[model samples]
Target: MARGMGRWRVLANVAFAAGVLALAGFGVFQVANRRWQVQPTFHVRAQFPNVVGVEPGHRVRFQGIDAGVVAKVVPPGRPGDPVELVLRIDESLRRLVREDATARIVVEGMIGARVVDLKPGEPDAPAVADGALIRSEPAADLADLMRRAGESLREFDATATEARAGLEHLAALAADVRDGKGSLGKLIRDDDVYDNLVALTRRGEKAVEKLDDDLMAVKQTWPISRYFESRAYYERDKVLYRPGSHRESRTLTAEELFEPGRAILTPVGRTRLDEVGRWSKASGRSRSEIVIAAFTEPGPEPELDEALTQEQADAVRKYLIDRHGVDSAGWFRKRKIAAVGFGAEPPRFEDETAQAPSRRVDIILFTPQA
Candidate 1:
């Protein structure tokens, strides 16, 4: 009876060990097959130019959901041939992945594992068949990204070095200027230079004034005056039967007539007034009247505002009379010239803004009846 009991105990132990080994083998088979935990899947192939960080057993995801696993990674046999990846995707989700579905390797997390990501194709498109090749986008590796970043940093360093060199050059130039080492430095440091410039400007002005007076005097001399008189008579006869009174007007912006916030005329203003001079010479009217009307927008100071407008009008009239030889004597005895200032007056246009066109000067010329 003891011998029979020992044999039965040994058999029982052997059966238990066999059962454990079978269970372990089944677990291994399930893990290797992968279909034991989910529905059956279909195999699909994808070719990629590069498959960095991708290998067999990597999880495959469809729209971020766990869908399959990479079964195999086949390296290219030829230099130009692409690396092939075999994927096992769930059959149920197969319809969502069409022939145009793209497969790309992606990083899972910050410096974590990588996975295969499947992007679904158009809904109306036909589904990809089993063993069909899906398109793949090559994954950019961390090493490549680091290399590019290094290149960019090198370029930025070069630029920074150049900027530093430029700043050094500028500092040296500024030091030279401060030490009165250059012509500009001398101009800044020397008061005599400023005084000389002022004296020269005054002399130039006097010379120009004298030249203008001499020219006017020559125009009014015997022979020249007779020629002008004859031209005037001829013009008058030609216009005898036409409308007797002639009027001309010009509108100028405040900026075109005077400096900002000052009645003094800028060089630009003088140049523009030269056009009026030319027009006055061409008019050839002996008995004419010029009305210089200056207007300004409302300002904080009423008296100063009016004074500015008056000064602007006066400046225009004086420029015409003094520089353009619009004399009020001899042939111009009947000529009437006036300057009028309309201070802080609203513009005639209903939609006029506060600035610009509202601040203007109007010059009007009227020729009397023949």
Candidate 2:
């Protein structure tokens, strides 16, 4: 009976072992096939300027999310070249990349883990195929990074040195100002300029006050002001209490009374049409245009030849033949004559007036170099 129990126990143990083995196999298969196993994996390469801190098994990310891992990092198919990073991209995030996706090495935070980050070019890009490698942007190394920081520190030291020099210079300037050395020093230490400025301000204030009083006195003298002064109204151009030269009539428009020579009917003078007829023809412009042109002028340039004389003016033919340059290109020279017309002066008001003297000059052809 004991032997039979022993045989039965052996068979039970064998069956239990087989069942455990089957369950373990099923569990492994479930883990492998689940969680996006069909998703896909893509590979890429990266180059680090230096690889002292980089190693295999480093996580690859996009933005901040985990998307892949570094599989292998080796020299670029040869010796003494940028090392390549072979990435095994996750199936879910692999679709985010395109053929033009860029790979770059990044550190998470200050003194953080180093990883490769892929920027999947544009948003609606096509997914990259398998086994293809994207370009890896060269990354700065630890030494290079430290060197950048050291350069910044050195610059800061230089700036401090400059600032110290500026302060010393300013202090010396202050000492000079106290000693009354230069113009600025004189302004600080002397009292003559301050006295002059104060006196000028007082004069200006007195002049302004006098001008205000004069304006008020003149306002009381006009006919419009006379009505206000008397506080009474009178008939139009009649019922006059007084008549004098101060109240004499004058012309404000062209048809009104004018000087003897300025009347439109006068001969041997600039007729009214001469001022107004420019638009009628193309010779001269209206007085209004002449005034506007006077204001809209480029400032004067220095005289080209101070020593140009009657000899030069008469020798225009000779200079053009000798010194004057020939226009090979024959580009047309557009010349304009500009001058200031200070309105007619005393002579213009008389019936018999002399011609206005023209303050103008003629040009000579001068070249810059021989």
Candidate 3:
């Protein structure tokens, strides 16, 4: 009888040991799966325009902390409705999730798993009820980003290739000029050509001056003077070359306008702008359009340079409008005032070259022809 009792006891011990091992394994599984919660959880709903790989069992976070899991992903019943996501959040976070809270599907780490990131609302806002909808922001489309990046890379590669070819051509031309082989080489090397060019330039200037004088005399004489006065005609020394209208421009160099490498106006810059303001006030008409354009030297980053030029242009525009009382708008007509920046890409003008003149601002006035 004692031997029988011993056998029964051994069987019972084995069963007890097996049960203990099973319980321990269950606990480990629950902890590892993030389901070992002591408190209850509540449901919340969010709608997204694009889920982008989100599915059930995906983690949800509240301000970057692991707070829940997505319970369901319900597709729209009809068309145009957003995809709905049901989140099971810890009840402890109920007060923190207010009515104004926002949700968005974001990649957790650098190209890591995707999760629902929650941004809690204001503290004074009402707490969100269970099963309440939370506003969702559209997911950041990784595919679109990748596609744009690829296009930019291709464009950069093409630009680099063109630049290399241009450099090679320029190097060959320079060598030819040095060897005095081409027409340009001869023009640069010959003393007689240089002297003739200088003399021709002087003669051209004199002719222009004489023409101006003769035109002024004619305007001041007889019925022409009366006609010009009615039309508000003024003598323009330098005019912008455009077909449709009369446009005049005052060019200001960056060296005299802004602090070195910065957008801030210097004392000299202010003085120069003050002179321009006075000119506009004295001669400008309300019906005319004023354009303030700024340019910068080409650099490695075109975007930064463009931004700087824009700021400079805006500064000039602001000063002219605010301080000088330049007419930016008319009573019955739309304002034609505009500010633009062309970084490293100056528009074609007379005697344009790759020189310091490229880095400058032009205040242009466009007036209707009488």
Candidate 4:
């Protein structure tokens, strides 16, 4: 019976050992399978000039979302060759990875770990094929940046030292000037120089007064007097009438007003004319004139273009008069309506293009100075 007990004990020990081994194996399987829960991954390759802090198993992010991981990293064969990385991205986000997508190494936080960032391409771009190579921008090296900052600080220190020396020399020169040791000091301190300057200024004032009297005499004399009067009249006219000239200039493209190569007003043209008529009535300017000017682009036959532009301007004027009752019998009895057309003449403004603005119409309100 004791021999039997010994054999049972041995069997019990083997059973316990087997159970422990099974449990350990299951735990490992669970851990391994957890990594691959987001299944059906697609692989892509990227070549970076520097992957200083990047390593395998580093996270891959697409537009800030965690998408995949770095699968492998291959060091460059030569000094100038780029380091190659194999990335396994989730198949579900395959659409986001396009042919034009760019990959770059980026840091997670301030002086933190590094990861691979993938920028998705335009929405209209085609999806990137599996296992295709994608472009990479190199990661910035922290150590290199720190080194450059140190060098800049050293340079600034040297510049500051030089500036200090220059300021010291300037201060010494200023001290010498204040002590009357230079020509500039003598000019500043001498009473004789001050008296001479005052006398010269008085003589200059007398000479200016005499010149002004001579000009006035010339302006009052015969033929020259007429010239001065004409100049004064012109200046007065400019001052009085400049603000009233082209007080309101509304430019309308030919396409907006009329059919192509036709003088008839379109529906849109009639709508715009209605707005202008309402504005004119609201303005209450009974003495103002309406001037309609039309322009055409240069054509093979200049005469035809001129005639077409004239017809267009006349059509607009007729529309405003007949449809809107802008006539010569009402409050606008004395107001004149004029239509002018320019064929192939460049606009006064150089910024005007040959496209729409050249083929245009301008409606201007001309108010004479009261």
Window of ten residues with lowest summed lDDT in model 2? 288-297
Poorest stretch of ten by lDDT in candidate 4? 231-240
Clash counts for all predictions = 0, 0, 0, 0
- Alpha-carbon TM-score of each model against the true structure: 0.44, 0.40, 0.47, 0.42
lDDT of 2 by residue, 1-370 (tens): 9999999999999999999999998887765444223447667666665555567677788877878677787866667767777787886776678878888887767556788888888777677878777867777565565445434433443454455565556556656766778998777755665455446555655655565455445435443234222212122112121222111111112122122222222222123323332322232212111110001112242121211221222222122223322111125532111112112122122221123122211221111121
lDDT of 4 by residue, 148-203 (tens): 64344334434544555655565565555556678876656665655554465556
Determine the backbone clash count of candidate 4. 0
lDDT of each: 0.71, 0.46, 0.74, 0.71
Tell me how far the alpha carbon of residue 298 in candidate 1 is from the true structure, in angstroms, after superposition: 73
Indicate the residue-level lDDT of 45 in model 3: 96
lDDT of 3 by residue, 35-67 (tens): 424458998999988797899889999987889
Task: List model 1 lDDT by residue over 249-352, tens digit each.
Answer: 67788987788988899899998889987786677377776666677878998656766886798798789878986645355274556666667764243122
RMSD of 2: 36.7
Q: CA lDDT of 218 in candidate 1?
A: 48
